[model samples]
Target: MFGSQPNGLSTDNKMLSFQMASDKVKGILQLKKYLEQFGYLNYKNSKNRTHENDDDFDESLESAIKTYQLNFHVNSTGVLDKKTLSKMAMPRCGVADIVNGTNCMRSGKKNHHHRHGSGSPFHTVSHYTFIPGNPRWPASQTHLTYSFLPRTRSDAINPVDKAFQTWQGNTHFRFTRVQDSSNSNIKIGFGRGDHGDGRRNAFDGPGGTIAHAFPPPDGRFHYDADEQWAVGATPNSFDLETVALHEIGHLLGLEHSEVEGYHVSLHLYWSH
Candidate 1:
């Protein structure tokens, strides 16, 4: 979304301007909504106390932009720059990186995390975090049963299987596939739009929100069926296994980290 102005913002000094604004009124508002949806903007703290057409670029909005920039390693200019917008448009997990005013992507120290390195004592300085309460399955429940919903794509079988295997290799969690849905602990499925979970977790077509999953005990994993999904990392198609592994981390009581793109290794920070 770009505005008619040279800097992609409105020339009218009535509202805050940015290069990503297509139409000063409509575009900027949509950007705020985007930020809000992914757990960025918190309207509760602001004096305006609204999520609508009020476009002032308030403190909360600027803070949200900075947090997003920090999570993605972009310049935390607090302004809607080209790099920020480009990243915002990319397809990502529907789960909010910031949950309940706590930036889940960046809450703890990277040095305090527990990880396994191949050669050195530490390979990555990546930070890891958990759900709000750190709810986890009992230590005895490490062997979990999983099954695919009937509506899930048939081709997802192998990729999902491999994803589970990868997790088993890295962590103590072991996943076993089952045919009977009633006897499974975790259920994986593909859905479109508001597929009965709720409006907050709805899938937006192909490129915006790709997939979402619940944290431990609530083991439902969903992928947006509208996306162009492929098994391995193929051209132009989203990798189902890669996403599955990330979602599986949620199922195992893990929140995504800032360094997710570079470090997908199992951190095993579970407190259970």
Candidate 2:
């Protein structure tokens, strides 16, 4: 299951890394539970067990665990090792690592961003890429409008604005807030459960996800109201601005950075 680390780390920290050969049954069970919460090992896909009845570390669980490791940049050992367990315990956004394939709009065009390296993918640093089609807002329209929907906490507004500022500082896109205006291009809000994005990726309450934003043209950004979101980093609380900055990247047609290793090549694909 889980193994104890040297230097006297707490028992809680050692709970999931229990060695499989040693068969720490309880620790292995805990590992299964953690993976399930993140949508890695679910009932339908696992061959031997469902989340409710899983006990043995089966192949299905192993594959999902490896995927989790790769997505988080952990060594893809496919075992419930200490580092993997420790990372699982960290509080992070609830956005699914593997988003639904149909949930995107593509233009099939490429952008000519500068390339940084050449040859080896492992040695090359990965930069952000857009969703397949490279969908983006109109570049000619420099000023994009935004506003918080009603029920957005007053204190949350400043951090959210600052998140936009982070984007504005780097990109040509400029965001301005509007009040009582139905025509704003970007709508920001906090929602619990399904806020009607017409997608399966709904918020999963407090801990699983922090926030998610739609890609350009959709312009719907949502933070899970159930989470302990803070303007700045706080113990046990998510930095609202940091999460907002990542989501806004989505708003600007960027997807999760997934290039493994290093390469000096830039590609952009989208349609107007």
Candidate 3:
């Protein structure tokens, strides 16, 4: 995606030049798209702006870049610098940071009211304010079953088990590995490219997206087989346990938190 630069932008310039030229750059466009998911960029703001290419850079895009930089603790430069690009290049979860269109969790009927006050009806609120949708595994159902498909390596088994253990230790839910894949509630596996998950968000080969998992009732967790999966964090080897731990949270209906000053999602602490 990094081919043609935006007029005056160069590696030496150390930033993506914008505003002066209306020409589009692919890498900049990709950054814009990714930043939009985190609510930094607005699609509506750029809809009417005319550009020479699809991946156009503009004032709104610059503002969004600045916002992202500020949020992530990067230098608050309005241009796409090397540091910013590096951070954006890191492998990450396929699931979105925000869920259900709100920062906090939601529950209960949409129109049902018990006549408490002037508050909105149909809202079954959560005791915990941080968790979005208050969505979590049923507290009563403490035990859950899972299975590793044949594609997942034997070496990866122990790490996966350890990852599950970490989750169980943190939360009330327990996970048991079962041999029967069909009967298992959560299915763990390694797949390359499109592994037939029925969802359009398939594994993007090796380095891009490491893994993804479905929420709650559909606890289907899959990792990119192409990635260097390992127990400990090493060069070029992404930590299997870390990713699995995050994915397990998803299986339990936890969404990624947008709150700053954390390396990962704040939902990871929901059990506490």
Candidate 4:
């Protein structure tokens, strides 16, 4: 659901003002409810504090905000100002809406093939031929890249990585982890400076487009800076492993499907 602002208001100032208002009044409670649903808010921390209108952002809360901003393509400033808040108020593409027969999942009739020297919708596979440090591909080969933000919990990465590896079994491709700036490849910052998700638009709707990745050879993926990724069931219901796998599929050139059947018939009919 989208919200409106008063007349004669500056677009930039509106998000910050709305956030302050949301923090104070219950008029725009959806955003706060969504955050609590995802387990970003710590009830214990607020127990003793009497100021309900103030955002007592801690390290974890800061992390959650940053993650959300990065995924939504907003500036990851880690400050919940007006711009970020207004973006958060926009409508999100719901999971059910993306399932099958939805506008979000529709694709054209074109078939994207990863042939040698041929450009296709599969950008990751095509870029492999030009990657400077990569070994030369076979005369005809296709490759994919899966990039994402690392979970704060070290334990979460291994299992999620293994799941992705298993999902790609027998495919002619390689996977690598993008480390922090210290490693020199491409650094991902969690909640500070360019990596922070404090912008007002972060996580506005449906957790604000959790994360995304570039196709292979390019090999760059990013996650929302404002999420509290959890391993298992929590009150907020964040599923780190599941979300990672979904985004990885996108990096691998798989678009969201429409109930998985529309294209199946086409494939079978064309097999002859």
- Model 2 score (lDDT): 0.59
RMSD of 4: 16.0
Model 2, 1-272: lDDT tens per residue? Answer: 01111211123654555334323345556566556644566655334554345456666667777877775667887867777665665544443444333222122222334433343221222245566566788779879999889989888789889878756755688889888546888889899887786445576566544577777898888888877766675766666666676677778877655433311011111111
Give a tens-digit lDDT track for model 4, residues 1-272: 11122211123442354322223323323444444433343445654233323444434444445544553445776666665565554322112212122222333332333433233222332111111122233435444333334544464567467645744552465555555433422222233223433343233323444444333323334445454456655544345555555444434444433333222111111111
2 versus 4: better TM-score goes to = 2
User: Residue 182 in model 2: shift from native, Å?
Assistant: 3.2
lDDT string, candidate 3, 1-272, tens digits: 11111211223332345434354665565566566554455555365355313576777777766766764668887767776665555566666543444532222221221222233211232122323555556777779999988767887788789878876754568889999999998999888777887544667665556678887778789888877776775656777766777677778876654334433322232322
lDDT of each: 0.70, 0.59, 0.60, 0.38
Ranking by TM-score: 1, 3, 2, 4
lDDT of 1 by residue, 1-272 (tens): 11111221222333335534233444666667778887888676676465445655555666778888888878888877766665676666777777787787688732344556564322344345777678798888999999999978888989889889977866788889999987799999999999989998888776677788898798899998887888776766777777787788788877866663332122222221
Candidate 3: worst 10 consecutive residues by lDDT? Answer: 1-10
Name the regions of candidate 1 deviating beyond 4 angstroms: 1-24, 51-56, 109-127, 260-272
lDDT of 1 at 168: 84
